[model samples]
Target: MADFLGSVWWMIVSLGVLVTFHEFGHFWVARRCGVKVLRFSVGFGRPLWTRRDRHGTEFVVALLPLGGYVRMLDEREGNVHPAERAHAFNNKPVWQRIAIVAAGPVANVILCLALLWAMFMVGRADYSATLGPVQGMAASANLHPGDRITDVDGRPVQSWAEASIALTLAAMDRRDARVDVLGPEGDDRHATLPLGQLPAGFAEQRVPELAGLSWGFQQRQAIVAEVSTGSPADGVLMPGDRILAVDGQSVDSADQVEPLIAALGRRGGPGMVEVQREEDRLALELTPRQDASAPGGWRVGVAMSAGTAPAYDVRAQYGPLAAVPAAIREAGRMTADTLGMMKRLVTGNASLKNVSGPVGIARAANASAKRGVDWFLYFLAALSLGLAILNFLPIPILDGGHLLYYLIELVKGSPLSDRVMIAGQYVGLALLAGLMGLAFYNDILGQLPR
Candidate 1:
């Protein structure tokens, strides 16, 4: 319940900030263009707080924090005094109207860029892909563990984060990605990993699920940070104890230990557990518990140390200007990746199981916030950029729809009929409703452990 509340709080704060900024953009631009903005709202539904400025624009904080809008005086919607007609949104020229409509999305993009720049200026810890022993299925292919990857597919890997990204992207292409590694033998060795196999739900059109499945290189260590009270590990494995191995498996790192515990279902234990505390080894017999949150019916009642694990070097800081371009490029890459994933979903190559609504977003927001301020800011920036892209999509009842109408007006030399406009709006609303419903459905389904 605490976790749920935290998620809600983070989601509200993050979304509210972004939405308010976005709406403010529209309000600012519209006012500048001599449009009479009636209401500038930070959210939907009844106003929780309201204030009227000297310009007579009613600024409001609404009940719902999901979204916001700027309402302008328009003659098409209602009766307008002859003197006020010139100040109405509809009376404005096409270019001015376009500018007003486009401002919201533009604001989101600017906010993202600013947040990213701040993030870099504040300086966050980043991993450098130094030599580490490789494990798992890829390890058997002559890629020895402890081979520091210097480059991937001709791209110089300045950091472990870059290497992880390269690995994931290379995996998507289903081709061998050349990785330059410094082997334990003190010699540089290049290994080509054939990463073609897609995960179980890779083709799922659901963005959240697909994003979750994209794994990266993680640090491996088995230090016990905390233990759940009354759980199997509590009173058995004390804090500061480094888990050595589970059963017969050689647990060299924390990563190896988790999967082993998860794999050892209820029946597999009463098993042998080995631990090292202060250079002292202790082996005890214990039965693993079942955690509903984790799959494969495996559980251990202990919190592990998080963030980037050992064996990776941390990178230095970046200047504000350098961070801006990097942030833009990153935003562009994320946008393209999102579009590609959407295409995959439409093509029936990706799963729809990953689609998430407000709930998922909130959960992710909370989780990211807990990770660090940098991560939280990064998430916000990404979401802001995504919102900008989505709002600009050619859909009715959206800014893009308004732009489309303007384009048609340019071609026909006249505005679209009110009837056509209303029809298009209804269609757009229905489409949006259906998509939201699907997203919510997916979100509910996601609550169940995979």
Candidate 2:
């Protein structure tokens, strides 16, 4: 329940801020174009709060936090005074209409760029490649246990975070990732290390959990958080028991135990497990259960504790004039990525599961917020850019759809019939409803524990 409420809170705050800014864009642009805005709303449904401005626009906070809009006076809705018709949305010139319609999305993009620029200015912590100490078995053969990595390929790395990203991207298609290390002397040594492959059936499969490799900046000691009732770990393992090993493998850390458990495939099989409680070392043999949530793995139903490790030696970068351009570029890339994902969804290459409604978005917002203000702001910027792109898509009921109508009028040298426009509105509404349903379904499914 607490988790649910937290997620809800996150959703409300994120959507509210985004929607308000978006609507304000339309309001500001309409006023500039001499159009009268009837209302500027922060949400839909019954008004929770309302204030009429000097311009006769009713500013409102509504019951729903899902979305908001700015309503402009238009002759299409009713008979308009001859003097006011010039300022009416429907009576505006085609180019002026397009400008007003495009303003909201433009505002979102501007906000995203600003947020990203702020994030860049504030400084972020990152790991150095030398942070992780090489373990016994993996370290023994070619690389020493304490060797600190200084470079990848030929690029000299000042910190481990930079080196790790370079190595991972390089290793994506290569069989081996070349590592340059700083030896005990002031000498540089190079090693061509073979990359680990996915175990048989898991190849070609993309699971969200295993998509990226975590550079071992921190080691977590495995302590049992909860023992599922009637599970294999229930009688054998209690809460607070620190896992030591599985089979004959030495598991000194939580990170070590995961790979061993995954390799063993212990579902429904008698498996040996070793754990330490206080000063006592205990061992037990039990059959692990198959967890349906874990698609290609066995589970003993244990939760491992983990947290982000601080990167103390990371370098900071900042430039007053250059940051703005960098921010714009970064925002543009994120916008492109978001559009690509949307394209995948429309093309049937991606599942509806990729769609996230309010619930899913809130969870993401909350989690990102916990990471840091910078991360939260970065997410907000990306989301803003995405919103701008989505609203501009050529769909009925959106700003793009209105632009489409204007374009059609331009081409035909006349406006569309009222009946035809009404039909288009219905179609647009239906499409939006379908999309909302899919997004909500995805969000609900995502909430189930994995």
Which candidate's lDDT is highest?
1
What tens digits encode model 1's per-residue C-alpha lDDT throughout 247-308? 86767667677678876654564788899889799997767888778645677787776634
For every candidate in turn, the CA RMSD to the true structure comes to: 7.3, 9.2
Off by over 4 Å in 2: 126-212, 221-317
Off by over 4 Å in 1: 127-137, 150-166, 169-189, 197-251, 254-313
lDDT of 1 at 259: 79
The local lDDT score (0 to 100) that residue 289 gets in candidate 1 is 83
Global CA lDDT of candidate 2, please?
A: 0.72
Q: Give the Å shift of residue 209 in candidate 1.
A: 15
**Candidate 2 residue-wise lDDT, 126-209, digit = tens:** 555553335332253245433567776675665654565455444333335667777556567777655434232332223211
